[model samples]
Target: MNAHHPPGQTAPQDRPARLTVGVVGAGRVGPVLAASLALAGHRPVAVSAVSDASLRRAAEILPGVPVVPPAEVLARAELVLLTVPDDVLPGLVAGLAETGAVRPGRILVHTSGRHGAAVLDPATRAGALPLALHPAMTFTGTSVDVQRLAGCSFGVTAPEELRLAAEALVIEMGGEPEWIDESARPLYHAALAIGANHLVTLVAQAMELLGTAGVAHPARMLGPLLGAALDNALRSGDAALTGPVARGDAGTVAAHVAQLRAHAPQAVAGYLAMARTTADRALASGLLKPGLAEDLLGVLSDTANAASATDPADASEGPEATDDGADGGDL
Candidate 1:
């Protein structure tokens, strides 16, 4: 670990004198990251929080850790992680820059998968090394998140001069860093949403429909099935796709639509839309005949639309809210 520390910084006898890291927004990612860095031998010197609950959580989660305001964290640490919600990042950075809270020689990083380092352009112009380091994992609020950091992939973006620092941070946390151009951020995040966020939605919908079908303990039953399906998908790619849509069984799909229409009227449209998309993918995979795919989609579409239009109350109620993949399978 000493050899792994970047040159010019002496390793601490008690803790790594690596860049003093300060975490902003002591929410899910902040405290977990602080703990992970601490476990990795780097000092997480200070953390910032705006709310009482956040401050309490920070203190409770990391006893003896100071929960200071944002400026204090920025002023005290060489590296500052702005882990605030995505919507507030630009404004927060801009506000920090305007107030001269962002210090020179400090590395400013955010954990938003949707935005690249460019979101911190204000801080960059103010002489900070702007960086984006998004860990590809959901963070459930706990010390367990520290352990989960290991072996995950991180999406990193930084200027050439600060690239090594960014890479070193990921490596220190036991993650492999994948460099992405700032301009490609949207598409990258979209892929994450489709794979991670929408997977949660799809799974929750499955569990709900399963419950409607008289399956006891929907979560327990769905867990292993979803796990196996995910494992297969990761190992075999599109070849792992299975079940009625993959098999191009229009009859099964039609029956499913009919059932949703009668029992779980609200889920009918979403089920049909997803089924159509799946059918399209199956068609691309050459698993489904063109005529059969069209016919299946047609049947689903008509039933879904008719059910949706007739029952206006049903349209507003979509699938149950899932974790948005922010907390992994548990969410």
Candidate 2:
């Protein structure tokens, strides 16, 4: 029971009382999160930073906090923030538990979108409170990330008994708490990765293609166009889609595929894949008629087959194209 509130009463509305916080990983995320917690009135006591970049980030974000080993950080902090990579988290927690570093009643939180509170079972077994609090925004290991936390949502997973405490901590860090079921953690993380990480790859590919087209300032040319496209997509979903594929312009799409195959062979596969998917989605969303979709699909199929026959090596690299027809379409 919290000392400040009676057993039957609800917890206070204001920020929770200050507690000594320690960070186990001073990577891009840890330092920024620790800085945010410090800004929320928590006392940052110790942090573990192995790399030179991590050390610099810690010095910049968590100025006075002592750099210590993970065990020492765990031993001294009332709340421990484990911000290591997802693959390393379970083993780290188990190793700390084996060494008796985690104490009873200490709050152990991990920042992995791929996992929920279940990944902290080792800490829980050591009698610590396990919580998963993954901030939805990307981190930069800079003060800018702290400000980004203001309107961000945190994917929180905890035992029913500790839900309020978990939410309180996220709220204090200037984030909204979104409860995520343990079973759905992987899918939830996959959605974020596809939306954010894949968007970066797509943008890079676009800029490279623009450079190939002799655009001196590709970003400046794409900025407003891409921004408006993103806004429309968000506001109207597939209904906002407007491109050669969406418009059922089979001839244009065939031309695009031929150009990509000849000059940007590596990008041909992605272009075909996205075009096929877009056609399917547009048809499903009533944005394109079934007859038009058939025409687009036929063009895509013939272009893919032509590309495959032109270079068997390219055919073996990406998704297999179904044999529909030869590449001699003007439709």
Candidate 3:
């Protein structure tokens, strides 16, 4: 229940001299912030990670800090980090605001890439300053997240008055701060997804293709090569391309598609999709003749359709080409 005040009176604004922070969802981001804040001489008042084990671990890391309910944290701290999953943040903020846990003049922030500070407007309407601070790095719920934060970039969204404070917090955590508008949160997150998640999928597809030819530890084989290729791609755009597609080797591409359909039918769809995209890029780059590029892309697309029409076991059959060797396409 919310404490009542007379009309025209507002919630109190008596923040402690030291910034007391409460962290919710002590998962990867939460625990990292808790430990880092404590190490940086900030007062970590309370942290809640949902599960008993998670709370116990967080308490262990920040000794003497309470593992309490969300409302309790908001009640106790001048700064609160709603680091829960993206879907839950709005409900949590609304609940806290409705229950009067988030008082006037305090700051509330969330670390969701897909949402902005506006999602915390429920709390803001109750007079708490809302901020969104999303780190542009990946985490695996480990202590290494602290080290990864060093020199990483963060996307920060907040009202003008709160932006400086949010950026300062990220800088203190050893991350560069990039300010973005609240309305652009979705596009901002899409860029991260395209770069991070799609990159993983692309690498996995390459490895699976290599494995079809009995290459043991394909990931290990491709790691350094892929890293260098990526570095080159970043340094030089379309000119970095060097492969069968770039050379307009339609015959080789058709043979490769046929071989993939025979040996790794399971990977044919993704392989064909990427190959077609590559063909388009190659043609655009003037590396491929129009007629050759269309033919090659047609072959790749047909290979995918054929593969999808078959079973997984059928997809695992031997290649059409007898030579089961690596071509090492410069991706």
Candidate 4:
């Protein structure tokens, strides 16, 4: 029995008991996950790493493990981790299966948030046991990721018969497993991309605007405000929203549009789009009064129309034109 087995759960003698692991991709996520499995007593047999950084990380995390070709890795491993990019995964699986690399009774797992186990159907036909185990946390290709695995949630998708094994593997890696239907994987991934990836973009935009406004340290300026806003949004959802738009301050919003157009034209579209969406959400959540919302909508519409009407060649000619008397509404 492996030394790290949990109390009261002994390996059965009748079953094949070896837990040799192979990682097919040594990218940011792959090495960390393999290290976590190693911590849970699985032996790291081989890893396929093509890039210099990946090879370096593998050396650091899986010391003394052989860097082998994909087929060799698959041949040696009882558990194979396919951690390539989402776009590259299907082709890799098909290629591996075509070359007779996949074997019966071996557990094949992928770390793509966009795909479920169904993407491994080619390998399934070759008799591999397929499972999709996507960690919800982002990776940095370092030791820190291994520590972060504890208490993290993995979005799991697998065949009914293999559910227990999949969940057990995730638990062994110090992660909780949340089952996701195969059809729902795309939407699940989209939600994470919007929440995490797009959040980075939004923060970048905020910092750029702050810099334009002469803030010497944009990170310091935004850190507390963003942290509190994120905490409140998570705790209270739309009910926690606050700002000029949420408060139905049409005049302040118009002033913002005018200033952005005058000084930072590139930010105008994104600002208006988010503002409109925020207004819609606030209105739906009953956070903004209907009459006030109408006024805010009118101001936004007028600003959008004014922006569209202005010629690109004339952009530097003067301050952006605005609808006559559109900013007359009270807050």
Candidate 5:
């Protein structure tokens, strides 16, 4: 590993210099990132944690790293990671810059997917190098996240002059950096939120629905099915869709709606919404026959109208197998 380069200078792209790293919000993401950087020979010198969970994570993930205030963290480290929530990032950057804590030639990297390098303009004007390097993986605030970083993709944004530095930092943490244009940061984050965040909600709902339907081991039962479905979806995109909605089986879809409304009223809205989307995509792809879509769409609209008429509890899961498909398979 390359030793720390002098301040205001960068090491060669192929040789990432080991620098003193500090974490400004020791949340689920901060400690894990610092830990990953530590593995790459970067020294974690200080961390800031306000909450019990964050404090614990900081200690557990970066033992011996002094717990300090944010300003102190900036004072002691060459590379400071701002891993606060997206909503809190702008204010934090502004506050730090206003206090004159952001030193010239210091590296300020934020892990907010919703933002890009522009969010650090305050710090940038203070002469700190800015990078938005968002790792596209869920974290558990534990050592497990260190392993998860291997091969993970990061949405990276930086000034053209600092592109290589941003990429090198991500690579040192064992992540692949995908360049994100500053203007497209919000949409890029939205796509990740739709795919990863909403997926957890969908899976949790599925498990809950299964449990309510008398399945003793919901997770165990659904694990393989969901796994296979995910794999297929990743490989084939819209073509991987193979449920009642995609098949345009109005009967099965209507049955699912009725059952969800009766048994899991909360799931009715999500089901109808996803079904409508699936139907639309299916028709667009010519996978759903227009003649059959009329009935499928009718059921969705009717169910949505009914669901909106009454208040429903939050519920789980998606289209369950009601009837056999033409191939004698269930959703």
Candidate 6:
């Protein structure tokens, strides 16, 4: 339970330093943030939750907090957390400002990585101090999210004058603040999407392929291998490139393409794409000899053109695809 005080009195632990916090959108991110702030001596005065899940989450994470309307939330909170979706953010800020819900001197912070403080221009113009503090970690919308904040990086963007305040709030939530230029917010978000979001898709596809290959406990089978591969990639980068493509083994590459087309036809396209990309990187890094790459490139081209590389026996090789092979190295 939060330390309660009489009307207008701040939490005694921090006295005037304690803020009356309000959550505008009680989604997975909002309630978890509110709970974290409460731990940092802030008072969660009110929260706005419309859906059953949001209501339940708020109740679970922020017990005893009042569920109020947006305007009422703003009215009660000195520090307002706007944790709505990126698309809904602009309208929410505009509406709050237009409805006179934006109180001057109040802190208006949002958690959208795609947007900086500019999305909260309406609220800013209304005298609210705008801040964009987006946590870099994924959220479960549960209490787990609060713990995840520890040492997590927060992409923080704010007006120059309010930079200190923005970073301070992020620190209070147990996050390390990484200052981001307003203009770079979109690109920063895109980089994270490419790394984190696409990674999830890639892992799901790998699991599906393993299951199709008759592998039981695919996750258990993959866990250690994937862990080591990820660690090696992080530590060694392109130098860590292995497998047939890196060694310029056209025969092994052809074998993989044919096997995928025959067993997991849907995986053929992705296989070709990644193999081609990996080959390109390997060649660029001198891991693949240009003279030895012709056969591999030719096989890829033939499979792509045919769109039906069904025969593993038909997969051809170059002189380099000798007994030495890619040292039977498969990733």
Cα RMSD of all models vs. native, in order, equals 4.4, 9.5, 11.3, 9.6, 9.0, 10.8
Q: Give residue 129's lDDT in candidate 1 (0 to 100).
A: 88
Model 3 gets an lDDT of 0.75
lDDT of 1 by residue, 127-243 (tens): 998888888887776778878888988888888888998898888888889998999977887788788878888788888888888999899998888889899999988788888
Model 2 compared with the native: what TM-score?
0.88
Judging by TM-score against the true structure, name the best candidate.
Answer: 5
lDDT of 6 by residue, 97-197 (tens): 99998889999989898899999999999999999988888777779879989999999999999999989888989999999999999999888887777
Error of 1 at 187 (Å): 1.2
| Candidate closer to the true structure by TM-score (higher is better), 4 or 6 | 4
| Range of the 10 consecutive residues with the lowest summed lDDT in candidate 5 | 322-331
Model 4 lDDT tens row, 92-201? 99999999999998899999998999999999999999999999887777788799899998999999999999999999889999999999999998888888877888
lDDT of 2 by residue, 207-307 (tens): 99999989999999889999999999899989999989999999999889878877788898789888999999999999888888899999989877866
Runs in model 3 deviating more than 4 A are: 1-18, 56-61, 304-331
Show where candidate 6 strays beyond 4 Å.
Answer: 1-12, 307-331
After superposing candidate 5 on the true structure, give the runs of residues whose Cα lies further than 4 Å from its correct spot: 1-16, 311-331
**lDDT values for all models:** 0.79, 0.84, 0.75, 0.87, 0.86, 0.84
State, as a TM-score between 0 and 1, how close model 5 is to the true structure: 0.89
Q: What is the lDDT of residue 76 in candidate 5?
A: 98
Backbone clash pairs for candidate 3 read none
Give all TM-scores, in the order shown.
0.88, 0.88, 0.81, 0.87, 0.89, 0.84
Candidate 3 C-alpha error for residue 179, in Å: 1.5
lDDT of 5 at 306: 81
Query: What does candidate 3's lDDT look like per residue over 136-176, in tens digits?
Result: 87665556767878898888999998778889888878889
lDDT of 6: 0.84
Model 1 sits at a Cα RMSD from the real structure of 4.4
Q: Which pairs of residues collide in model 5?
A: 205-316, 205-317, 206-317
By TM-score, is 5 or 6 better? 5
The residue-by-residue lDDT of candidate 5 on 96-144, one tens digit each, is 9999999999999999888899989999999999999999888777799
